[model samples]
Target: MTTILVTGGTGTLGRLVTERLRADGHEVRVLSRRAQPYAVDLREGGAGLDAALEGVETVVHCASTQRGGDEQAAQNLIAAARRTGVAHLVYISIVGVDRVPLPYYRSKFAVERLIEESGLGWTVLRATQFHDLLVTLFQGLGKAPVMPLPAGVSDQPVEVAEVADRLNELALAAPAGRVTDMAGPEVRSLDSLARAYLRTTGRRRPVLNVPLFGKTYGAFRAGGHLAPDQAVGKVTFEEHLAHRFGR
Candidate 1:
């Protein structure tokens, strides 16, 4: 079995991908800030990353920072991969990174470009926002009596496990650049999702529709982040909520 390196393997998607691959008897190295032997901050490329990428056939890059440093991390990873002759580099990105003008999206798009031109075998999968992320968002907003959500914005959220499964498949198979997008079966509005969250947690919070400004908000409102044609994800947001809340 080829040794695979999974960056951010301690996180939700990485953990799932690592579990699946390891269960199949593959030698999987988890690379994170605290992962032993492979422990190295990807933002700063160094001997640690080179050591981790040594003899690694494939690298499933799942590490990303919302605050900053994602571009630097990918550059570091790519440099290390090139140095160690990594054959395949699997990346997971958002559906609308190229279309949306948000800071995070811009960084993600830049990373994608870097991989595409990295002169290595690469497969990039752009997936819709995760259900877990939506839960986190609603949770943070739910603390207030009235949750202020972006107006006219809808989300087609795929399950994290599904995305992980897809990544696992991509990690094993030959590099296929820019595969089909994976999205939730249903495209539900923010208000509807918030209401479902309220029902699930038995919490009442009036959702306020705040019309956000700028191109980012406009793109989201225009459904730039949606993959209506590729609504291939089976799990619904309601199902995820039920399972999470033990309903």
Candidate 2:
């Protein structure tokens, strides 16, 4: 059995991947800011990182910062992996990072470049938006009687559970450089999805279509953020809603 070290093991995707790996009989070591199995803080470098990664052959690098100091943090993690002589490193990335001109996405792109040039065994999987995005969209829309859908925006969101399963499989396989993109089984328009979601949750709300401004919005509207052709996810939006609201 390979001893796998998982960074960000307590997070949404990380947690699931860790559980799956452990259940599959791989010896799992989780890196976290706090002590559980192993303690590591990629942001603030120290002996902790070195100790946690020592003797681990494969690493699942799920640690990410959506804001503040993400680049430096990712670099630190990479440096630690290099120093420890890790055999393989797998990074989770979003599909739209190259097309979208968002700050956070730019950081992810930068990290991918770093991993490529590091001369280490590496694999990157670019995943689409998660089913959890429905909750974020709902929160953004609030309780308005008529919610404005960003006109022309489309999505091929995946379930986090499916993403986790793929990550575990990657952890066990030989590094393939970069894997095929993963996305949900359905192609969905933002407006229709939102309306369906609200209805399923027993909410009565009308949707209004409106064009949105900015390059990020434009990129999304042009279907730059979706991966429709590579629909590998098993969960549907309705199933996701039912899981979330316990319907």
Candidate 3:
């Protein structure tokens, strides 16, 4: 059995990926700074990482910091993988990171470059924003009487479980550089999504479509984050909401 080490294994997507790999009968070890069984800090390069990657054939890198420092973490993972002679390093990245001007998106793009140049066999899968992320955003915004949404911004929110399944498949296959982008089945405006959330969760809030200015909004307005041509995920945001709320 191929021994695989999954970083951020306790996270949203990481947890699903770990479960999928284990269900497939692969020897899986989860890496987390706080969790047990495999406690290794990606930020601190030392014996912990070395021990984690000792017999690991593949490393599914799902760990990321939206607050920054993701590039450094990726570098640390790459160096450790090289030292351990890991056969494959699978990385999960956000869609349109190259085009999105947000700092978090830029950090993800930088990690993509690092993985590409790391010389280690690697496969990078860029997926659209997850449904859970959108729901959380709307839930936070829905607290107010009026929810503000960026105008002309559309999202193709894919399911995290689907992305996790794809990551599992990629981990088993030979490294293929960057695979096709993954997106949700349908694309909807941000305002519409927010309104849907409000209706589903019984929150009565007026969604205000505010015109957003800046490169980040420009990229989103231009549909840079969308992969209509590569809409491989079958789950729609509405279906996800329905399942979540039991509607």
Where in model 1 is the C-alpha error above 4 Å? Answer: none
> Compared with the true structure, what per-residue lDDT tens digits does model 1 show for residues 66-171?
9899999998899889889999999999999989899999999999999999999999999999999999999999998899999999999999999998999999
Candidates, ranked, TM-score: 1, 3, 2
Count of clashes, each model? 0, 0, 0
lDDT, candidates in the order shown: 0.94, 0.86, 0.91
Q: For residues 1-247, could you state the per-residue lDDT of candidate 3 as single tens digits? A: 8999999999999999999999999999999998886787788768888888998999999998877778878888899899999999999998999988999988899999999999999999999999999999998888888998888899999999999999999999999999999999988899888888888888889889999799898999999899999888999888899999999
Regions of candidate 2 where Cα sits further than 4 Å from its true position: 35-37, 143-146
- lDDT against true structure, model 3: 0.91
Error of 2 at 35 (Å): 4.7
Superposition TM-score, candidate 2 onto the true structure = 0.94
**Candidate 2 weakest lDDT stretch, 10 residues:** 32-41
**C-alpha lDDT of residue 79 in model 1:** 87
RMSD (CA, Å), candidate 2 to true, equals: 1.6
Q: What does candidate 2's lDDT look like per residue over 203-228, in tens digits?
A: 87778889779989888888877888
